[model samples]
Target: MKRKTHSVLRSRSGASITFALLLFLVCAVVGALVLTAGSAAAGRVSNLAQSDQRYYNVTSAAGLLADELSGKKVTIVRTREITTKTVTEYKVNLAGGAAVNANKIAETSSARYTTKLNERPEVPTELADYPTDTNDGAVFTDLTFLDTIAVKLLLDDANFNTDEAMNQSMKNGPEQKGVLRVLHAGSTDADPNVGVADPSSLSVDCLYVVQPDGTIILTLTNSTDKSGETYSLRIKLSPSINETESETTETLSSNRDSYTDSGFHETVTTRTTLTKTAEISWTVSGVEKVVSAADASAQPVETGTPIETDSP
Candidate 1:
């Protein structure tokens, strides 16, 4: 009976040792898996931080270059590698100015003049006829001015080529006779107002006068008022000349890409590029000066016409 009891005790001791070994093996496997997951998460966070830093460095460098080039008339190319992770590059070009084209200038100027007339209010019928007493020195007596009056000198060319045609057209006045009409405000009809002057009686001297020296003159006179009132009308001309001058600036661009290896079998690539341009314009006012395509940048330059008002 003593031998049997000892055998049972030894068997129970062996079973306990086997169960403890299996439990220890399972815990070791779970610990290794947790360590692997932690390492992967740390690597991902490191890559993200590096990428964000690279992006910021590239953008900041580009902005600095752009600010330095503003309003400067120069052409240059520059490249910089801030670090292994960031690169930046830029190119700038200063385009030179040229005289405005002739045909374009004429078309643009005519269109602008027509547009101005269309936008103005119609003059009253009472003011249409010239005063019988030219000695009084007033175009209209006791006139109710309904709209601001404007006058502009135009270069007329039949084929827009021959000097003779241009001279004849200028001397004879525009192809279409200058007609004054009485228009009601805000009317869109084709014939919104009645013609105030006899077509044959309309004279170039009343609106525009051309000189033998190729200088055109515009005049506005009103002496009939008891107050003897006079006015200065805002005038705009050479629409094409303005647009062509504005387009003198030109823009150019370029791009480049590079790559470098990061640790852990990873690679990082960066791309950088830049574009820059320059601009110039010309302006002229009054009919005394001629703005030909050959001499677009003439003297007595103006940036643009002043805003028009009806008060005068």
Candidate 2:
């Protein structure tokens, strides 16, 4: 009976040991799976952050280009039709953990430029006054003043040439005497032609004039006709102020009320002066923008956040 009891006890001990080993093995496998899942989640987050950074860079580049093309100043206006190119590059760093493991990145986008040469002059209301004689010495009146206008226009076909036509059209002014003269800023005295002379070449025109009151006016314009092409237009103006001049003189006269004539025919004299000046006035207008050939197919789908930094 004792020997049989010992055998049963030993068999039971062996089963307990086996069960413990099995539990340990299962626990180890579960732990390993949990660690692997956590690593994969971290990797995915890193990838997303990198993607967002790249988007920020691209958008920043686009904004900078827009500012350069559009400003408050009148540029010389490009002489050639613009063709843009995209140059993109990327750089990465691993020091910032999986969240922001990227560093400095740069991209350059450029476009060819052209000028527009067909712009309308702005008109302004002005006051004019002139001195003539003693009675009704001066006259005051209002005048409608015309400002200078110039622009650049892009043509539909690159091969087309319209230089001569443009000059002719711009020179078609009234033949009557006292007609306003339109002098091309830098044209020769023989032919003061204005407007784009060649359709193939981009045209840039600038206009300048002063009103009777000495007020200056300037205008600029831009245009294009390329399909899928984008153009930006900007304008600026500066006017001059008028100045006045004056003079003074001395004179001597006898006192008639005091009866000073008894002492003798005292020397009598008189003094007088005339004043003249101009009044200037001006008005400006004709600011416009247009685009052609937008690519609908090229539009990209939004995959994530459209903005760069959420706050700053």
Candidate 3:
């Protein structure tokens, strides 16, 4: 009986030993699986961090490119300030007068009747189409006896179309004398020859922004100092020039009561505005490409991918 009990106890001890070994093996396997999964997760997280950094840098570079293109899109704006005021022009004209030969100078040899009087002076283009509004009286009169009456009427018209006359006429005037030689002269509401007047000749600058159709947001702002290569923008601007001329006639009467002669006065008005618009039609420059080879190659070599052979 004692031997049998000893044998049973020995058997139980062996079975316990075997079960302990199996549990040890199972624990080791589980630990290995956990270690492998944790290592892979850590590697994936590290790679993601580097990818994010490289992505930001690349995005920044792309933004710089877009800005470079934007900067090239430049244009000129023109602006003009116009000053204008209405003014009353005063002039006195003497009518129906014949040249009474320089106080007894012979009519046949009068300087006023000289051949030089027949020669007309050449005028600028602005004034070529416009002629004087007033008529100079003829050398001879109907009444033979009255020919000796009008004051020598020495015509001094050299200053008539000069700048001095133009500027002076703008100011106070009784301002002129002798178409008919009335002392106070006469008053005309408007200048008959205003038609040849200079045009507005004004310009203004305006900003044009191309319509934003795609709604592309420039999340990043970038710029370059390099003067971009010259290129033309096929953009168009509405440039135009317009000119106008108008004339009106009114009855003329001497302010002085002594004269009751009926005559017509002419008023000419002209306007011109000047601007050079052909500039836009030519070269509208903008850089083609600004990024240099060095710039592109300078990116971090291992930023997105870690190729370290020693990574555990």
User: Which one is best on lDDT?
Assistant: 2
Task: Give the whole-model CA lDDT for all candidates, comma-separated.
Answer: 0.27, 0.29, 0.26
Estimate the TM-score for candidate 3: 0.24
TM-scores, each model vs. reference: 0.21, 0.26, 0.24
lDDT of 3 at 274: 22
lDDT of 2 by residue, 39-79 (tens): 99999897665444333332333333233323222211112
Using alpha carbons, what is the TM-score of model 2? 0.26
Q: What tens-digit string does per-residue lDDT give for candidate 1 at 92-205?
A: 122433332211111100000011122233221111112221111112223211111111112222221122211222123332222222222333447736642232221111
Colliding residue pairs in candidate 1: 122-183
**Alpha carbon lDDT at 83, candidate 3:** 18
Stretches of model 2 off by over 4 angstroms after superposition = 1-14, 71-153, 156-312
**What is the C-alpha lDDT profile of model 3 across 1-312, one tens digit per residue?**
899988886775567767888899989999999999999999999766444433333343333334433322111111111111112232333354542221211111100111011122212112322232222332322322111111111122443332222222111222111111102122343665644212111111111222111011111111211232111111111111121222233323223222223322223222322211111111112211213434322222221232222211
